[model samples]
Target chain A: MHIGALHISGVNLQEVEQKVLDVAVNIICDEKGKDYLIVDDNPGSEILVLNADSAEGSKILNNASENQVKIVFSSSTQSGKNIITMPTPVRVIALKNVLIKIAEQLYAYIISKKGHLKAVKKPTVLPEAQKIENIFQQLLQIKLANKCSLISSTGLPSIYIDGVNGRFITEKSTDDIEKYLNLDFNSVESKEISYEQLNEYSKNMPVAALNSILWRCALACSNGKLLPGHSENTPVKLTSWPNFSRHGFKPDYFKLAAIMAKQYISLMELNRQTQIPFKEITDFYNAAFAVDIIETVTDKSKLKKTGPIKSSQNKSILKKLAQRLGIN
Target chain B: MLQLNTDKIIFTGPVGAGKTTAISSISDTPPVSTDVNTSGEERKLKDSTTVAMDYSYIEMDDGTKVHLYGTPGQTRFDFMWKILTKGGLGLVLLINNDHPEPVKQMEFYLDSFSDFIDETGVVIGVTRTSINDQANIEDYQAKLFERNQIFPVFEVDSRSEGDIKVLIQALLAILAN
Candidate 1:
């Protein structure tokens, strides 16, 4: 019998890896050896001992000519070793199986952790933000298409906009547009206007005012996406003109949606030098505001769906948002 | 609740005259629709109703809501016509001249909504069959004048939301007066 021992650390003996190795090595030894009959000496290989006192196990160990069973020890808490008893001359199948199983366990852990880390690091913007961005792009397209061409007799002067910087364009071109058209766009003055301009502007201001409101909303909802929870105190990306009680403005979802609608209306009312009808703008805004409650509720619900969307939902969301603004 | 305000003006028109696309061109909520007509014809390879008459509302900054009721153009859904016109301030009757009896169809809608017209008045949105027909809208305007008091009438593309809004606003001015 072979008396050999193997020290396998880094594994709790009760764990699957150590147990598998013990079973495989024991099975290989018993199949080829006779009890107390053989004696061999092999010192190069590690040994696993399940039965320490059997004479057949000692003889097999003494006859281990290939140095296959180097050492053997009991598998008790204090033993701290793998079981190696008999030595088989044919093959070392158990050692190979144990190593393969450990590799598989390690590979599985790495794969699962990699997936978990990815889920934890996804983008956190709200889906609604993409929708708003798209709406902005669509508005830009509309505005660009309807952009005034200054037929200065020399040629149409090209206005280069760095981006959708309305304030930049307006500041740059307000004087020129006012001077060329021979109308005092005096709102550019102290942001000032006379009684007549104010009235006409107010009557038609619904659209432009509304557009500004949506612009604010798109701003407030910066990178907003429909997430799966509601956080009321979370800062809305747009500025809220909620305090304008003289006009009966209450900053709610309807007000927000109303603002967006007003924005779209204002965009359309600016047909080069053509004045859009005030009543038409009013009706369009009125119609959109009429559905304010429905939209707000829907917006609230949608914000709870997931993290924000990618950029693809922008165009469709913009078109939908434009209608909500009652642009026509 | 999310009820459409009762006072908003609605533009009720017939199909194949560009209702949904027109409304959507300007509508904010994709124009809340119940469109069996579009789906039905789409499956059969026939004409589709761009706008199925449904309800949508717009609100003024002063909190006044304008509800637009788009009516399907098909005569089969004419039952919806009456319901749609119940509280309407006016109607934008889209008269498709491509129809064999376009004038007659306009008359049918006008006559069908005669009581509503008597109360709220109506406008004519004439879809010109060909661009060359200079007096086509005027011809319908004349016909409308004979049937009802001269209401606002114009050549319009039902697909354009802005154009439709202009038509409705004209009707609104008439109603206000």
Candidate 2:
């Protein structure tokens, strides 16, 4: 099967052509003739990017067809001449090389099957949750009015994110919903129902602010990556702060938030300043982004070097107080 | 280990804003309050009010004591407001969202404590936001933005110790930054 779209698992795909590294992405492969499914976890993805370090790499590699360029995140020791293996946390330049390789392979395969197959559209690659985020984003933008219910494979109660009221309508307990926020949406389809139907079912159900679910979901599914538009090299600041009281606190979230509110710094630079883990910082970014508070720095000239933030006078006292309050 | 009064945090806002409850939430011991029955217009909102202050302390493991002082909310107690804020590290301004024009109340507090806020910093705790539909966290932020103010604002319940700590933690974080 020619790389119609992409299917991904594990590794967070980097951007190609300023879009996510999904193969002929956003376009659905409607017809199925056992042609090929890169199928692992990615919903609309055709290319299957596996971690070469993972045992599942070789097994899935063998399943890929000629037109499909299967990518593996190779470790320092691993090497394969016939297959594509880029480093983990693939650099932009390396990702470009892979895109070139995929293009060549796709063109050759298409020439071999001229007039046999149809064409598909593609965009920057995205993880499964990013695609799901697109739906929530449209709801936020007021462009999408489709009343839908999200159903997962686990047979849990269906959850409805009511864009109208900015609430979640569900019979499921908030605790249960939080637990499954990192839900696999590959096979999960949001059953679009009528507005009347949603109202009838949601009348008596427990409701929560939709931002709470979105906030936690972003944290759960971020997979240590920022959204496609957010560049790792670009600094960011918050236009508004997350309502931590409602969203529930993650450890050190306040610290990262303090920095975000005060300075415009990239995640890497923020990590250096605060000494908080890079992954945790990205998780904070995802949550902040999902809550719609994060803003990328518009002017590089406005970015200032973050100096020491600890108060000169109350440094000791603040540390003591933070310690007593269990935040230190 | 008890090191007395290295720094103090001032909790202030309009009447019924939960300063006393907030102080008690993170205090090491029961707060000492000079609460008395409310009079005239204020009495309609609550039975009693703090005429002076609510005093509490947080003691570190090594005996450093950070003080917490809650100012009386009524403007008539403005004399004690200045007195209580002295030697303070920052302010925790709690606004009762259920009050008519809670954002206005915040503006009043910010104006009253503008000097103290400038010297230190302030974190706002918008209490009773759930009970009030007229205002949300964004409205408070919008007010701050209009005033060219940048401060952390949280939707909080003064009764929740965790919520109280977050406010204080955010205050500390802001000061550090």
Candidate 3:
């Protein structure tokens, strides 16, 4: 039995089933369809081979001739008695097992999320985007509800997202927001005003000073970490990922938590004051949470602890635990 | 019974120049203001925590309902100026005599609404006679004439409700003519 060109380095047959399962078609060698070639005949399979420089090597050609796999190669070879005319590198065929696995995983994730793989079109609101934003806002609101004793604005629609935990409100009519919510927005007067002159004036002001004001306000209102510069949020760690920090994706949970905490405090503070307009407080809170003033974290962790974590206000509990452990 | 429709007129000027007091004198009801304590930066613009803007409904005897918007003195909210001027028929630019450069303030409003004034006439309202002694309201009136073709300029105390109404009447007359 002559083995033909059996060089496999980068190909992981274990995941091959998964990668090509959806695209791969089963081709039965016999009429009964019982025994299949289990071959990945999909055009997309070409993505597997990143480079074929080594396959053009003379040694590899010799290896193929010895294997007697009836090599019909792509490249012209100088020597080989049994070697058929060559046009390209010897194609290494694999069992259909890996492609099957890829198809299974893809369908499983799609089903789990109730999502169907569709080509993304520009300017269209994707359901997945709304879902992610909803999850983030819910997490922030839940965290803030527990941590802050008071919230400032009443009759205002605002959502807080964790990882940036920033409060975003529609200063414009809730028409756009209602479209996203897929519901009618309650009628409320919009009070947040943007002064073109003032906005431009602030742009001329020192960004560092503005950041300092934002940090100080957030710190004074509640206990939250003032991250270094703007890009210092904790990175998100997903459990199923192949490797940590793969492709440099970081999640900023701390900044998100801090922003929500401040918004909760500011809203509550506004509510406490009878005469102060709630809209102004909302604007201040928004200014503080502006992306330019804060940063996000990029380091991801492997721990997948779900559920509402302890509120930021319950630092005393941690302190007590520290005392019990005799650690300061 | 002559039914008249009143358009929203936003009076924007420096703080202590009495934007709220000016609009309140002519409005049927007290204006809703977002007033708060002056932060360190705002104290320079306002004697106290001056209101950013006051919204009041004005119903003309002719059944014309107009809204009057008064902005706070601090330049901090120049952003809100655009929103207030979005559909404004015209602006009543109030100038305070107490400010060393009342003309400069008028120029600021004009520059802010240069585009708006291009489409609609701006009525200049000068408040506080004491500060106007050096050049008087007439000097500013001349300034307005030089800058605008249809700009209506007047001298009045924004503190008195009736006197401020006179200014609105002047704006109405200019708009009517």
Interface RMSD of each: 29.4, 10.5, 35.6
Contacts from the true interface found in each model, as a fraction, amount to 0.00, 0.55, 0.00
Against the hidden reference, what TM-scores do the models get? 0.33, 0.68, 0.32
Ranked candidates, highest DockQ first: 2, 1, 3
lDDT of each residue in A264-328, candidate 1, tens digit only:
21323222213434333333233222111111221234334322122332233323333445542
RMSD of each: 32.5, 17.8, 29.3
Best by DockQ: 2
Sorted on lDDT, best first, the list reads 2, 3, 1
Docking class of 2: incorrect
Residues B1-177 of candidate 2 have per-residue lDDT tens digits of 112343889999989999999988888998999999988988887899998888888888998778888889888889988777776899999999989899899999999999988788889999997788577786676567546466889989999998998888888877877
- Give the count of colliding residue pairs in each prediction: 71, 15, 50
2 versus 3: better DockQ goes to: 2
Please provide the root mean square deviation of candidate 1 (C-alpha atoms, Å). Answer: 32.5
